[model samples]
Target: MHWSTLVDAVVVAHQPHSADPARYDIVLGAGVRSEESLFDLPAAPRFELFAGTTVAAASAGRCSAVDGLFKPRADPAPVPMELIGCEPAEPLLAALRRPRRSERNWVHLLVLDRHGAEMASRTVGLAITGARPSVLGGTLIDITLTDGGDERPSLAARPIWAQWYQGPPAEPNLWAPYDTQGRAAWLDLTTRAWRVPAPRPDRSGGEHHLDGRFVTDVPGLHCAIAEALLGPGRYFGREWNAFKDCLCGGFGVAPPFTLTWHDAEIARRALADVVEDQEDGLSYFEDIVRLLERYGVTVVLR
Candidate 1:
C-alpha cells in the first residue's frame, strides 16, 4: 500500500546524522494501519520508513504525524526585479562593482512550537547593502618608504637573496628596507561610510534588533531563529539540545544571547504572558511564522 495515503503523518524523533541515536515514533489513530520500510522516497529524501492507514477515521491524525517529521519544503522561484534610479550614482555603482562572494551572505532559520506538542520552522536571509572589500579585487599592492637622512646613497640587498646565501657578506646596514604588502596595505585605506541605494522597500522591515533579553514561548520559532543565526550544522546541534532543554529548564550552556528561547513553564502558565513578555510582542518562534509568510518560508502543519 502507498504509505502517503494510509499515513496521516510521520514524526522523525531523531535523525541518523545526529549525535544521538535516530528513532521515529509512529502514532496511529483508533484504526488499523500498515507500514513499509523504504530505502528511498523521491519526494522525502530523509525518510527511511513509510506508514499509512486505510481507515478514514484515523487519516487526519496519521497525516499530521507524517507532516511533523520534516520542515516544509521551499519554493525556488525567481525573485522579481524592479528598476530605480540611483541617487548617489557614483558610490552606488562602485559599491555594486566591489568584489564580493554571494555565498557568504548570512541567513536565519527559526523553528517554533505550535500546540503543546507541535512545532514549525522558517528561514530568513540578511544582506548588508552598499558595502565592499577595501582592496581592489585580486590585486596585490605594497608600499615602501626610503629615509633621505643618510648622506650616502643607501645600497640595499634583497632579504630573500641574503637568506639563501646564509648571511650577507657585507655590513648589515646594506640590507633593503621592508615594506607592508597586499591585504595589510588594504586595511590602511579606511573610511567611515559610503553611499548605496536604500534596500528595496519590500525587503526592509521594522528595525527590531534581536537580543538575549527577549524570552520565547514557541519552540519551533526558537529552532528556526537558531537555524537562521547559527547556520544549519550548528543549528541542528542547538535544536536537539533545545528540545531536550524545554523538557527541563537549563540548556547546560547559558541561555542563548543571540536567538530567543521559550520557557516551557511560562508557556504553560499563559501564552498571552509569554507573547507579551517577548521582545516586540513576538518570540523568536512567532517571528519565524511571520517571516515565513512574507519570505517564502514553507510551513507544513500536520
Candidate 2:
C-alpha cells in the first residue's frame, strides 16, 4: 500500500470567472507520504450542549435546553508544502508576493496507480500567499483551502481511504465493506474521480447489471451505479442532475439497453425513506429506476 505511486503531481492552474481554467506554469511534484500535506485535515472539534435551569426551580412543565448553533466548519489552516524541482513563473511569483483575494487559482492533484494511469483528480483552492526556497531544491508554498461550500469540514480522511485510491479492487462490490462514515469518504473521493483512463471506443449502448447489495444510501447508490456502468473507481454521477447528464450519452454508455438490478430489495429498503423528487413521490431507488426508464433503459429490478 505504497502511497507515492498513488499521486503523480499537483497541477496548478488559474481559473477565470468567465473562461475555462487552463494549466499554469507551476507543477508541484509529489513527495513521500510523510511530506504530503494536502490531504492532512485537522482534527474536528468536540461540541458540548449546554443545559439551562431557572432559579425558581418550581415549574414541572417548562424545560429549557437551548439549541446549540455551533458552526459546522471553520476555515482550514494553511498547509506547508514543497514542490520538487519546479521554478515558479512570473505570474505565480507576482501573485505570491502580492496576493489578491479576487484572483482564482486551483491545485488539482492527480491520483495515479502503479502503472501511471490516472485514477482520480482531487482539487483544492490554491491560496499561496508566500513562498521560499526549500532544501529539496524546490519552492515551499503555503496552501490554504477555501470553505467546502457544503458545510463539511475540510479535514483529512483516514489513511485507509487514501490507500484504497491505489485503484479499484480486482473484484466487484468493492465499496460494500465500508461503514457509513467510510462510505461517505469513499463517495467524496469517487466524486472527484476524473475519467483519465483511455475512453472506450464504443460508449454508445450496453447491457449492464447493477449489484444493489451495497446501495445502502444515496452516495452508495452512486458508487454502485458508476461501477455498474463504467468500472470500479469510475464516476458516473454525483446527484440526480449529474446522473441525468451521464445518461444522455458520452459517459461510458448510452441508453436503450437492459439493466438487471440484482439484490434490488436491499436498495429498495435502504432508500425507501429517501426521495429524489417530491412531485413524483418516488423513493430514491424508484426515482433512479424511473429516470433510467425515461432515458430508454429497461430496468429489471430483481
Model 1 ranges with Cα > 4 A deviation: 1-75, 80-95, 107-244, 251-302
lDDT of 2 at 179: 66
> What's model 2's overall lDDT?
0.60
lDDT of 1 by residue, 192-260 (tens): 001122322121222212222222334323323433333211121222233333223221122222232
Q: Which lDDT tens digits does candidate 2 get at residues 35-76?
A: 342343235433221111112122222212112222234555
Q: How many clashes (backbone N, Cα, C below 3 Å) per candidate?
A: 28, 1
The C-alpha TM-scores of every prediction are: 0.17, 0.55
What's the lDDT for all of these models? 0.28, 0.60
Kindly report the root-mean-square deviation of model 1 from the true structure over all alpha carbons.
26.8
Give the range where candidate 2 is weakest over 10 consecutive residues by summed lDDT: 48-57
